[model samples]
Every structure is written in C-alpha cells, then in structure tokens.
Target chain A: MQGSQFRLEHGKKVRLANMDPNETGSLHDREEAEPNIERLKERLEALQNMLYAEKKQSVLFVIQGMDCSGKDGVVKRALGGLHPQGFQVHSFRTPTEEEEAHDFLWRAHRIVPAKGMIGAFIRSYYEDVLITRTHKWISEAEVKKRLKHINRFEKLLESSGVKIVKIFLHISKDFQLAKLRNRLTDETKRWKFDKNDLVERESWSAYEEAYEDVFKQCSTESAPWYVVPANHRWYRDLAVLQIAVDALESMRLAYPASDPELDQLLEQLQE
Target chain B: MQGSQFRLEHGKKVRLANMDPNETGSLHDREEAEPNIERLKERLEALQNMLYAEKKQSVLFVIQGMDCSGKDGVVKRALGGLHPQGFQVHSFRTPTEEEEAHDFLWRAHRIVPAKGMIGAFIRSYYEDVLITRTHKWISEAEVKKRLKHINRFEKLLESSGVKIVKIFLHISKDFQLAKLRNRLTDETKRWKFDKNDLVERESWSAYEEAYEDVFKQCSTESAPWYVVPANHRWYRDLAVLQIAVDALESMRLAYPASDPELDQLLEQLQE
Candidate 1:
C-alpha cells in the first residue's frame, strides 16, 4: 500500500530534509482518490465493529503535526465515519495545574482507550519531548531520559492490547505560511490561527531537527512513525486513512465465536 | 413533554413502589412511539452539535439500573444515533487496585466529559451508596456522609458548566426474572449473564430501598433523578431520549456567534 512507503523503519536515521512534504504517491489528482477514500472509510467502520465485538484489543492513533498541518481536519474527514461510541478523539493542550503535578504521562495514561475501543491523541506525550526541548524548558539530559520513558510507555500499551499508529503530518514551511495567511483572511478559519505559530515559524528548522531526533529515538517495530506528506489536504487525508485501515486489518480482528449450544438456546428462547 | 412526569421533583419523597415500572404514558404501543423517538434522536443530534460548537457547557447522563434493566440497550438504541465525535460513553465496573486506593468519586470525577461533550456513565459513583449500602459494606452513617459528598461533587460539576441528568431505569422483579431467563436461554446473550446477579437478586428489596434513599438525598434542583419505567424496552428508550433531549434543550445551547470581521475576512480570502 502507498502508506507503507511513509512508515519510518526503526533504528534508522531519518532526515526530514530528504522527505518531500508534497509527495502524493501513485495518485495524481483528488478526483481519482475520492472513491478510494470512501472505500477505506467503509472498511474502517466495519473493522471497528469487529474490534468492538471481539472486545479483546484496542487501537490508538497518535497524530502529531506542526500548526495548520491538518491534524483536526484528518480526524474529521478520514476516521470520522467510525461509530462514535467506539471511537474517541482527545486533543491535548497545555497541562492543567493537576496534570502539571504528576509526571507527563499521567494524564495520557488515564485516558488511553480501554479494550475494544479506538482512541486518537491529536498531540501526545511526545509534546513533552518536542515542545519542552524546542523551548529549552528541559535540559538535553532530560530529553534523553524522557525518550526512554516514552519507548517503555508505548511498549507497555502495545503489550496490553493497544495497536499504536503514530502519524506525523508533514507540511512544508511555505505551505504553513500559506495556511497562516489563509487563516488570517478567512473568518471561518480565524479561530484556529494562533499568534505563537508565527513565532514558531522562525524556528522551523529547529523544530524539524527536534522531530527527526524523536523519530530516531522513539519509533519501534510495534509502533513505527508514519511521516505523511500533507501539503495537499486530500492526499494527507487519504494517506492517514490508508495507514489506519492497514494497521487495523493487519490485526486479523474477528468477532467472538458463537456459543456452543446455539441451537438449543435458540429453541428455548423461542419457546 | 411526557418526560417531565418521570423527572423526580427535588425534595419530594420518592417511593419506587408507587412508580409503575410498566407505565407507558401517552403512547399505547412501540409503533406510536417510534416516530417520536426518531424525531427526538434528530433533535438530540442537532442539540449535540450546538453544544459542541458552544464549547461552554457539557452534559452528563448518569444511567443507573439493575443487572437486567437495559442500561446498555438504551444507550445503543436511543442515544446511539449521536455524532460519535462529541458523544462518549463510559461504563464503570469494579474499581481497579489504583481506583480503590483513591476515594470512590476520584475515578468518576477524572473521567467526566469536558465542555462541548456529552458523556454517559453506565454506572457511576452512586454505586458507592447503593451496592455498598445494600451489602452493609459501609456503615449507614458512612453512606449518609458519602451522599452529602456526592451532592457536593455534583454541584461542583454544575458550577463548572455541567448539566447533570441522573436516570434510574426502574424494572419490575418479574421483568428482571424474565430477562435473566432470556439471558440464560439466548445464546447471543449468555455472555451477559453473571452468577453474581442471582446472588444480588436475593437482595432486590434492599437495593430498591437503598436507591430510594439515594433519590431523596442526592436529587437536587440542578441535577434531578428521572425514574424511567423500564419494563417495556421501547418506553424506556423513548423516555430516556426525551429526558436527555429536554435537559439539553433546557440549557438553550447555541453556536458561538459569527466573527465580527467575517465580511472583511471573506473579501480578503476572495481576493
């Protein structure tokens, strides 16, 4: 599948400079991709039903992206078709006073989807590494220590039946500038524009370097990072949907087996 | 609305014996109710959208019922039509070792829905008062103390922009027996039957009385308990839907006003 091309291999050095932010593999236009996007959505919904029925495993999608990289848009357009009862989306922001008291992972750990559920964290504990390191809020030694903690945390969740799919929506510096200008000019999108984004843009290269380090340190065999080219919103949505559907399909999910005394029970119930 | 009749008035003495579990007010049959249920579901979806857009207040539906009283069924049939993105359902079972280490309300308080969300707790902190009391696990004075704490906790949630709607799914002893038997005989439902339910059935009256005490103590003007007659699954689903819709409507939810610079922004975007 086109999604496999984006999956970063573990223990390999990642150079964000080498990865194109506008790559749309195989597909040439939005019209051609629309039908496939719809099909994948239907498959995702069906797979979610089986996951809920099986009640044995769960899935977590950790979505990371720069501002205006379409994190919210991908969720609304791609995986929004799943049963709301089984699918949940949580957008992480600045930690609350209570959250600040505990270790960084405490808040995320509490809300990790239970068995038979699918959860998405718009920006996750990786924020502890990315944002904290970018702002020099934590020391270099602290970043190294937190990376080890994050790897162990993902491994713990994976062992406990959570299929983790980490997706990084990659958009170019020019693309982010265009989105920011559009946000300023479009009132409907104005609510989403943040002044800090412009300030963060100045540190674009620094942020990219930080992300590269995160990929090298945290990506694992069980939960590798998929860096999606996200300049075109249509391609970004399709790629994330394909990656999610592929992850769930690979789990070999099925409904729980029927009862042994089904005929007898049916007759008794009928009576 | 027919739902108002089921909304227990605050400070009034509640007698479960007086409330007919089989009562189907204003509707003679399921066909008569189906259309109204559909309308209510649509209204609920619209209201939920407004609530989410407003992003100021949240709604919490605390669903309490006996083992066979159809708590799960009501959620699926009635509220299931909601946009899954804004609606969340959390089913509380026995507390884990971590949950047990904290106060009873600690675990529940942490998971309450945030602003612009609707959360339903299949069973809630009320378990501390009901099961704990029925089994004499906690002293009567302790139950009284916990009841006060619960009222306070609910008020806190209300002050922080939560609309609390407590629902008690009232079912007759005979009706429960029939459902239990169906679970035993029906192959698909066999997994739902618990041996402990039979043990708890022996203490049905104690549970009922304990529930009555809870209604008297915990029911507040801000958050009243609605005793939904649950003998007929159709009526139960419809009534809960009606009550939920009414509570959200009473909040008078509205989308945030359009931006003041919308026209100018549109002009700029067009350019």
Candidate 2:
C-alpha cells in the first residue's frame, strides 16, 4: 500500500478513534502477505547497497509506538536484512546526565547517520512531547513550543539530505493487553515485562491525544508521518517494509560517476 | 584455524615477512570453506543477539589493511548478518578540520560502541602513527610518541569493558595488483579506483614496517592483533567470523536475570 494513504495530511485534524488498527487492506493473513514481505525485504537491501555506494543522502526511520506495540520487532523483521556496516538503530530512553543537560535534540543530532547510512530511532525526540505532555509533567504551552522545535529540527535535517520517515505504530488497546500478558507468562520473555508499562497503560488515551497533536503540527510536507497498522504483526511488517523501500527508492540513489582519469590509470596498471 | 595462532605475540619483536598472507591452513577452495563460513555467520548472529540482550560489554573490531586488502568486503561478508541496530562500522578517511584540531584519539573515543553494541573501525587512530610516519609528515620521535598514546588509549577502552579485536588483512603485493586490476576493469567497481591508492602502493614496504612496529608496540594482551591471511577471500571471511563469534562467546552474555519484581507483576496482571 502507498504510504500516502496513511500519511497524516498537513493541517488536518486527527482522531485516533477514526482509524482502524486491525485493517490490513486487501490482504487477509500472514501466509498471503509472506511473499510480498520477502520481496520488499530483498528490495530494501538492494536499495541500501546503492545508498551506501552513493554516499549522498541518508534515511532516518523515526518509529514511535506505545507499550507492546512491536516497535523493536518491526525493525528486526522488516529492516533487519540491511547490512550492519551501513545501518544503525538508536533507542532513546531516559536521558543520561549529559544528554539531559542539553536541548532535547542534542543527543540525536550528534549521531544522525552520516551520508550513506540508514538510521532508525526506536523512540526519538518525539518522546519529549509525548510522555512529558501525557504525564502533565510539562505545561501545555511548553509542549507547543517543543513541537515547534521538532518541526524546525526535522526541516533542518530534510534540507541537508536526511530523508526522515516518521512512523506511529497504531495498535488497539486490546492487542497491547494480549502482548503484555504473553510477555509476563513466557519464561524467556519475562525479562522484557516491566511494571512501569502497566503505569504507562493507564495514560493511553492521553498518549493518543498527544500523538494526534504531533501529527497535525509536526508532520510536514517535507517530512511526513505514517500511521501504520500494528495490530496484525504480519501486515505491520509488510507495511513498514513497503514504507522503508519507498522512502529509499524516492532518493534516486546511484553509485558515484566513474572518474574520467580511471581509463588512463587502468592503462598504467596494465603495464 | 584458531585466532591465537595468528595473534601478534605481545612484547615480542615482529616481522611481517615471516607470516604467510596466502595461508589457508587446510582449506583448499571457496567451496570447501563454504560450510564453515555459513556456520560461523549463523553463530555470530546468535552471539550478537545475546550481547544485545545482555547489554553490558561492547565489542570493537579494528580492521587495518593496505589498499585492495578487502577491509570493506570482509565486513560485508562476515559480519553482515548482524542486526544493524546494534552494529556500526566506521571508516576513517582524511580527518576533517575539526577532527584534526583535536588529539588523534578524540574522534574514535567519542563513537566507541555503547555497551551492548558492536563497532568496526575500517581505519582508525593508528593512521596518525602510520601514514604520517611513512610519508615523513611527522618525525620518527613523534610516531613513537603517538604509538605510546595509542597503547594507553586502547587500555583505557579495555578497562571500560570494550572487547577489542584488532585485525590486519594480510594480502601480498601481487594479490593487491590483481584486485586493483579487477576494480579498474569492472564498470560497476571503477568508482572505487582511487588514484591515491596507486600513490600509497609505492610505499608498500614502508607501510609494512610501520605496521610491524605498531604490532610490536601496541598489541597488548587485553587487545591483541590478529594477522589474518586475506589472499583467499573465502578464508578471510571465515577466519574473521570465527574471531568475532569467539570474542562475544567469551563475554558470558546472558539475559538480565528475570527481575524478582516481575513475578509479583505477573500475578497482579493475571487478576
């Protein structure tokens, strides 16, 4: 599916209740989606190889999702085929002392992928506006100010060859409950369960409202946000893969033009 | 096939002439070594997953080699299976003006893998001692001084729980000629033919001597150097993969001990 179908329209009001998290378009099940998943994964890798060779534009995947929404899973399943040398994923948690000392974007700005690489931010500076606003830790005015900062920060990145693809993994509240229960019961996955997630779950509606505002204010024409369906894991992976492939394919990546002197140099080496 | 056999012995004088760049041990051809290469690549992915979950120590693979020595190729073939989120590769080229203003180790120090990640440095701070010394850009005494600085710098990193695996892709002069010719003649690879590679080829012996001194002076037991034969690309890939897997395996990685609080949380969730 084209990401534009789900992309947040600029200046349009967003209501989380209106969007269906379980919708999978024309596709039905994991089995049916498997072929396209494999094809897109291969295409993603081929495009990444060209991006690495071209060394001109970089791609950033900003993925944000609530508890048990499969943020990390989508990256591993959809984008994992990428060569490690040219791809990096960054997960922002509670800021370190040094990071907290600076503006919210400082930590992220320092490690934005250099030209020729792809970087994924599992949860990024968006958290500053999300959790802070949802928890009432920061005043609503402060949230507005930060959103403005975010739009500007993204524009700055876009102007300089960073193609930002912001993604919000949309999952129903019931789906989250199932995922959380499974994590708690599975012996191997119990380590991943946190009581704090339960506390965060209480603020789900607040989080949704905050995200809607972000989509309306921060999702610009140059750097739009995709609200991907995450209730169905298979569909989620395929959609994210298509979004990633489309993002790179639009960059028009190519290997550097062969140097004119190479012919003369080739003759010298032959001798 | 053990890395120890090729490891530079600390506190011993080194001679590049004695080691065989074309050595493949018992392996005869690419087909014969394919099984081990596949096995090791799979093993590497498993180990890296543990390292990411364990989130304690980081691994740094410092790769150094002459022109056409396959530094980039080795990472693509041997370590490419890694999850890009936890793996990063850095290729140090001519230092930027800002990087040159700081100490040689400054740039490398800032980007060492955070705990739980793996990083590969294509060319690193060692270049300060190498290219500068070989071309007489700096005095011999200055090179000696930089070598001392590098040893201490590595020790500092080792103490901070960074497992360092230094590798030298040892390929012969003749082998490089063949690789360079291939690049020049291949339309797709012609962009990789750097004229400076020809310039650096003239100082091959000087470069070897500089590297030998580095191996003798900087190869600490905590972070020893492996001189892997690279004339055969298949053997090179397998050996590097084995070294990488062994490094992570030795770290005793494990999932965070299931938090005792998680059991109570699980009980509460079930209610």
| lDDT (10s digit) by residue, model 1, range A1-271 | 5668889988788988888988888888899899999999889887987888788999999999999998877887787777666788888999999999999999999989988999999999999999889999999999999999999999999999999999999999888878877876654456555667877888888888889999998888889999999998889989998999899998998767766655465465456
Q: By summed lDDT, which 10 consecutive residues of candidate 2 chain A come out lowest?
A: A185-194
In the order shown, the candidates' DockQ scores are 0.17, 0.51
Q: In model 2, where do residues sit more than 4 Å from their true spots?
A: A26-35, A185-188, B13-15, B29-32
Error of 2 at A79 (Å): 2.1
lDDT score at residue A95, model 2, on the 0-100 scale = 97
Q: Give the backbone clash total of model 1.
A: 1
TM-score of 1: 0.74
Q: What lDDT, from 0 to 1, does candidate 2 have?
A: 0.88
Name the weakest run of 10 consecutive residues (lDDT summed) in model 1 chain B: B262-271
Cα error of candidate 1 at position B214, Å: 3.7
